[model samples]
Target: MHWSDRYVGQDYVADEADCAVLACSVAREVLGLDIQLPGERRPGPFGRGALIQQHQADFARRVDEPADAQPVLLIARGRAQHIGVMCRLVGEWWVLHADEGAGSVLRQRLREMARQGYQVEGYYQWL
Candidate 1:
């Protein structure tokens, strides 16, 4: 199952489940890992303490070079809210994520999203 499908159309309002949580939850379920709120007691990329950035680095490092790894999602919010997948230099694009509020886990172009500076702070992958 694609991560995009898991939470498309799901309401995140009042949940504070940002794009990072959405992608992480989908990855956990797919990887058969127990779902729990990711720990926030870690240092962030910037000195301001951003847990999401740390999670992304951790997740990315875990699967940095798996031969059979699938593409991961990159989600962003605010003025340029969107979702996209990471792909091999020449391989099928994985359905990494989608704008759930858009009610569709549609495949998106990664380059465009990256150009907009959406922080790809984490990833979902099968265990």
Candidate 2:
């Protein structure tokens, strides 16, 4: 089945599941790859959890297309640790992600994950 079908009614948080889910959906749609599981649960390449590393790699290797074609970089964060998609670029200070709180995707501030103290592990993607 398609990823969209699997995502129906799937709830998420701003910096947690919502970001991860959005990143997964975008990766699948744009990259045609899958990154759901890993050898073992470990921190992401650039972060402290599996999901962040997975999403970052997927975006860099695949989704970092042309400016006009570049898809959003979905991410997972926070205590609840959810995921969301990066929908668009807003100027130079912010990137957009799907916000479950609003029941729709929206753009928000863009901060370096390192500065924010977030980590990554493995991730799933489409490309």
Candidate 3:
């Protein structure tokens, strides 16, 4: 069974069950690495990016290619505010993430989400 199956369709709650939380949970469970994030977004425009950078420094290793269980950071409307766990299915990378608009956890093609206006910033594996 996919590790992300349990997270699929989970209701998204700000500062609770959102993308950051879900991504961290997935990493810890699947990679056995604990990456921490704040429940509430920090103030200012770079809040999310700052948090991600901190986590990366703490335990994440930036990788050039996506794998079965890597975390991907996404940018929407030019803001670094979303993160997800990626799984390779049929040779395609799919992201497992939750959002308010989707209202739940969903798996979507990386390209699909990119077409939806999310720019994939980077992929990382927790160390």
Candidate 4:
């Protein structure tokens, strides 16, 4: 079974299933890759930022336009605070994330998120 399939409808927990955890969960479950993230094991946005920066070579930064199903990291208020898997369903690009606000894993339109002021710091392809 696909790892993503396991997370559909799953709820989000701040320190347990937050953005970073969700992203890493996908990596471990789907790709069989284990990434060690820093910051007391429950790192926040800044910690995630450091993790991305440290492993920059393992990712190809997205610079052009956004695409579907790409792993992305988002920034809010100039801090890297969110991460998710990009997905396209029903002809719309959505972010599959463990939303803190919604308190669950949900899919939100990429455009709408951007309109709400969340900046796509960058998207990355695992290498």
Top TM-score prediction, candidate number: 3
Clash totals for all candidate models: 1, 39, 0, 2
lDDT of 1 by residue, 3-71 (tens): 355455555432255444554565466445544545553322232134444344444443553222233
For residues 1-127, write the lDDT of model 3, one tens digit per residue.
7676777889998777878778778877887877665455764438867776665656667799987777888887688777888888767889988866778999998889877778888887776
Q: Residues 1-127, candidate 4, lDDT per residue (tens digit)?
A: 4335567678888777777678777766666767555545435667656766666565446546555545787886577667788776676777778877678887777888876557787777654
Score each candidate by Cα lDDT.
0.43, 0.41, 0.78, 0.69
After TM-score superposition, the amount by which residue 17's alpha carbon in candidate 1 deviates from its true location, in angstroms, is 3.0
Clashing pairs in 3: none
Model 2 poorest ten-residue lDDT run: 117-126
Tens-digit lDDT track of model 2 for 1-127:
3323333344555444554446555566655656453323333333434454444454444433323213343434543243433322444433334555556544444455434443322122334
Q: Judge candidate 3 at residue 127 and give its lDDT.
A: 69
Q: Which of 3 and 4 is the better model by lDDT?
A: 3
RMSD of each: 6.3, 8.3, 2.2, 3.5
Rank by lDDT, highest first.
3, 4, 1, 2
User: What 10-residue stretch in candidate 4 is worst by lDDT?
Assistant: 35-44
Model 1 worst lDDT run, 10 consecutive residues: 41-50
